[model samples]
Target: MNERMTKQPKAIQAIIFDLDGVLTDTAWYHYRAWKALADELAVPFTEQDNEQLKGVDRLNSLRWIAQKGGLALSTAEEARLMAQKNAHYLELIQHMSPADLYPGVQPLFAAIKAKGWKIGLASASKNAAFVLDRLGIAGDFNYVADANQVQNSKPDPEVFLLAASGLGVAPAHCIGVEDAVAGIEAICAAGMRPVGIGEPARLVQASLVVPQIAALSIAQLQALA
Candidate 1:
């Protein structure tokens, strides 16, 4: 989606969120699935190793896992492994409830709404809709940019730009909350301010970096403007 704003930008009129790491800890579920595949392939996998997969697409994630084992995969093999990993991930996330949503998600949404700011989700997961449904906050988002709708993933800005379009706001009038470097880069590339939801060291490029969602206050968000 195009991100060039025709009109002059305004204050933060929208807040866009990344799914797995920002809204929920489904990154753990993803790690578990990839770890299972890694174990099967005798690849030495650790939480640190899984960090590289954050904000990455399913196919690239598979490549990261396979590369760990120094394994080369054919097209068919790659598809099969990705499907298997996704199946495992689906099973792992089946038990998710609103309780699984990260701390402050609800309150954050309410706060944003109070500010007259729209909220949208720019998740790389094709299951963004399902996960939002599982969390019982599907209606909270003014728009949810489907990963399937974007031509490129995070670090490319297409998805974030799409979220801006869906929100009927300029990219410059948005704050994109993310927990990965790639996501932050995407937000920046889309011309939106980035609220990094992780360690400051890991997300130094963000306009504002908070330890987690709850630590991200309205005061901090307002300052981004």
Candidate 2:
């Protein structure tokens, strides 16, 4: 189905968002936590390696780090490592406030809700609910489909599909905004319009690539959808 370049739908009834890099800047905390673990293990994890973790699950990211360190782990060991990383990340984000929301995020959310568009959050993080609550914006979304609710992560299309279903909107009638390659692919594969929120080159597959969500408008989004 050449999902990489699908046609936009005539209307966008729902806007599904990825939590970390999109609505908040928790990606930095994820990277810092991973980096701390890698350092403790004497692994050569760099910022570039962290980039590869975007839209990927916590355990998978740990696995990738282990692969870089040339280590194989038992299931229990992997679970321990995953828990360690998550604990570090959770600690880092415990101090987050609504001030952590990206510029224009609240206004954009308000504008979208004002237009009666359903908002859904589709994030790989199990802490998505906590983050939203801490930001005091938990009520902003119509529904949330996080890692706990999905068996698969981004690039599998499961999360986005679930978000669309939760929003009671057809996939074709939803627009997904993401900042990672896997997320954009998931949106496309889910048969929804993909709106990239980062580098244009990295998200050339999206229906519309913008520098940030603040740069997008309801009219622009509708037209793209």
Weakest ten-residue segment in model 1 by summed lDDT? 1-10
Please give the lDDT score for candidate 1: 0.90
| Per-residue accuracy of model 1 over 1-225 as CA lDDT, tens digit each | 355665434688999999988888887888899999989889999999889988999988888888878999999999899899989989998999999988898998999899999999999998889889999999999999967898798899999999999999999889999999999999999999988988989898897998889888888988777
- For residues 1-225, could you state the per-residue lDDT of candidate 2 as single tens digits? 777558533677899999888888887888899999999888998888989999999878888889999988899999988899889999999999999988888888888998889999999999999999998899988999999998888899999999999999999889999999999999999999999999999998998888887888888886875
Task: For model 1, state the Cα shift of residue 83 in Å.
Answer: 0.9
Q: List the residue pairs that clash in candidate 1.
A: none
Question: Worst 10-residue stretch by lDDT in candidate 2?
Answer: 3-12
For candidate 1, give the lDDT of residue 5.
Answer: 64
lDDT of 2: 0.90
TM-score of 1: 0.93
Instruction: Give the whole-model CA lDDT for all candidates, comma-separated.
Output: 0.90, 0.90
For each of the candidates, the C-alpha root-mean-square deviation to the true structure, in angstroms, is 4.3, 4.0
